[model samples]
Target: MAKVKHESRWYPLESGESVLDGLLRQGVSVPHSCRAGACQSCLMKAVGGAVPQAAQVGLKETLVAQGYFLACTCRPPEGTELEVAGAEALRVPARISSLSFLAPDVLRVRLVTDAPFDYRAGQYVSLVREDGLARSYSLASLPREDALELHVRVIPGGAMSGWLAAEAPLDQRVFLQGPAGSCFYVAGRPDQPLLLAGTGTGLAPLYGIVRDALEAGHTGPIWLFHGARTPAGLYLRDELRQLADRHPQLRYRPGVLAGGTRDIAEGPLDALIRAECPKPVGWRAWLCGDPQLVLSLRKKLFLAGLSLKDLHADSFLPSTPQVGASPAAAGAR
Candidate 1:
């Protein structure tokens, strides 16, 4: 017999259970979405212990060489102690119950999975379409229910978005790999403040954070800074307003980037985030948006005194084509 300790509770088993299942049973929060390990959402560090090279984790050769293994596929080898944290990961899988237009160019997609999808507020999923097309989207679903909602921003020459907008069926079977990134709310650390920066379709994940905070009863001050090229670029404004109305702890500021004459306002995002929460000393931040915005905010927040560990983010992306889909874009420099 072997002892499996997780989340402070030990589950003694004749055979070790899958690493993720054991962790969840013990209440240890490890970021994961696509349990199949295709999304790399379950990336975790093994403090001490070794896994068989041919065993189930399906880790890449490079990652295995670095001692990186998948917790979703972990099986203990007698007397194994595990230590995992919320790092760069998130994901969830659900069906499109409905898709509506929030703006002419922005989409509001509602999804509900057959299984219970557990994810932090700021996490997101990769929406997959027929013909091997994929789109990265953040969950707008509130913590109040199991249904997942996502805000989608279509880009020109994108296959997934066009199919989702015009051809994808409501009941069609599409696969998703997520609750996949490190972007999310941290309620346990309520002693520190929280800053949420959103741009364009980025409101999807931010909305999730606000709902989770309200539900978890985090009393700390929350500053939300959202930016868009025009008011039209701001998806779910009405929903955000409703969220603000419901929670006194949440304060939201909407900024339009196009209206700028003063030298101070380089962009709407820069103005809103810098003006309100100028310092990130003890606060935790969740940022989701265009890659440029995500990268810039991470840099700026660090400069403002926030430790690298304190900042979490997910860079939004458009539909990626597989078979007739366009090639993957180059990694940002």
Candidate 2:
């Protein structure tokens, strides 16, 4: 028998039962999704007692260093003490400024915080609605921008997406938690060729990161691959094309799955990247959008010569009870 602590309450952790399961059994509504640990929706911090190393697997170094572990995977020993993160450290109060359709299925949302909030371009934040349901969305706006921008794709039957698309009102106040993940571009790597790829709305973070790189005066060639199932699914196509035309160092390639359009490359997005840059030995890669695409491309790019250290990604898992399938408004991003 083990006493597991969350907040001020103590719950019994039966032997062989996971922390998430035990907590849920006690009616403790700790947010969680993908109970297998891939979504990071059940993240918890150890307040006292030793945290099992296995519980922190696949977490970012910064999170691991901060004593954060996934509750869904935590099979702790007896007497383990835990604490859910406080809202203050993880949440920022903000209000929605405006929402616009980027595509038939995608909406661009902007949020203005009460105070200055700092975050890298490629990081993501969890948007919590009035009902207490929350969903993760990548920030498409840069830190210097006046408002936080998120590109959301409507997913069929998704609660948060449906709410944002049909129910959320203007000037709505929402709590935003996080700017987490280490997939952003850093200044020191200016000389390294950057390869960015995404499917559907995955372009949100990739768009922000690309702008950040350009603003930092990156001298190396910068390539971006955006893929969609059809031309109508491609949001910001004209804008990205204009950006490419303006920056000689930047290259934008649009990939389409069904029809072979002259303006867009035909094939899977990962295949598009493979064809463009066969040897990515010294390149740094950023991938977002669908989880399968991100995972498969990560492996493929690594095998194609990109250093494992140089590759970064944010996989949007399908939205579940406590987990979000990133960019919940349209296509995978």
Candidate 3:
């Protein structure tokens, strides 16, 4: 049996069990998705073990050199010990510049990093408070916009959300880590049709991506679907409408759960999206928001002839006290 140590806990790895399986069997919660090793979400470093050779497959050379390995695919040889990668090495200083509501429950948060941070439009950064509580939020502002912007939907009773909405002091300082995830607009695909869909504050990342695509001079059709529970939840309505009107190739569609007298569709957003394009062949797609919604739409897009390589997603999982997916239960791919 391999002896695996994660944090302060130790587990006896059963024969043929991967490190992740062992950790999970011991009741350790590790944030992970696409456990097949493709997403790189369960990345952990080998502190004092012989990491399996296969664990480094497809990883960047720098990461490999730094002793990083995917816990999902690695099985330690007998007598190996390991630990979760330390996050302190990745955090940088940031300060909240402004906080204002986009809706009754959602706040538009703008922060300025102590140093310039370069990231793609659809990536997310994890914000850490002094108490060590942290949550990820997608960047809604573009790189050229000169600020780090996020749309934070205040969850009732949520620790981070409650403080930020009601109790946070002005110019509060925090630490940020990552411009992480794989969902963003890539350069040189100017003619490829792009599809962006999300529910609630999930629109945050999509909003940035739309502007990035337009700024890149993409000439193909760009479709956006922002889902909400009601008309009042449809934040940024006029702004998105004006944006669409200014760009002939952009189409903005807001979806509502309960039917109402508006230009938006009623029902689940994915159903409305399918009604818009029954066949999504050759189109690149990005999905954020609810985990079930992202997973469901991902499958539908694949069955509609979209390749997995062309579909990117970020499904927000509920945050644990020490770690989290995102503030609004949404993340960027």
User: Which residue pairs clash in candidate 3?
Assistant: 182-333, 183-333
Q: What is candidate 1's lDDT per residue for 1-333, written digit by digit as tens?
A: 445443345555346576766665555555443444444545555544565443324444555565666665667677665443322322234578988998887777788876677666666666655433345567777656767787776554445566677887897766565555666676586656888887777777888887787778888888877777776666666777787788777887777767643322336587577877777797888887777888898999999998888888776643222223245321110
Tens digits of lDDT, candidate 2, 1-333: 766877788888888788888887887766554566655556777766666898898777887887888888888776665555423355678999998889999989999999788799989877777545656788999999999999988867667677778888989998876666787998896778999999888999999999999999998999999989988888999999998898889999999998868898888888788889999998999999888899999999999999989999888876544323344333222
| Top TM-score prediction, candidate number | 2
* Candidate No. with top lDDT: 2
Location of the lowest summed lDDT over 10 successive residues in candidate 3? 322-331
Q: In what order do the candidates fall by TM-score, top score first?
A: 2, 3, 1
Worst 10 residues of 1 by lDDT: 324-333
Q: Please estimate how well model 1 matches the true structure, expressed as its whole-model Cα lDDT.
A: 0.64
lDDT of 2 at 194: 95
Listed per candidate, the RMSD to the true structure in angstroms reads 11.3, 3.6, 4.7
Off by over 4 Å in 3: 1-47, 51-61, 69-78, 83-85, 321-333
Give the per-residue lDDT of model 3 (tens digit) for 120-145. 99888777787655577788999887
Q: TM-scores across all candidates?
A: 0.67, 0.87, 0.80
Evaluate model 2: give its TM-score: 0.87
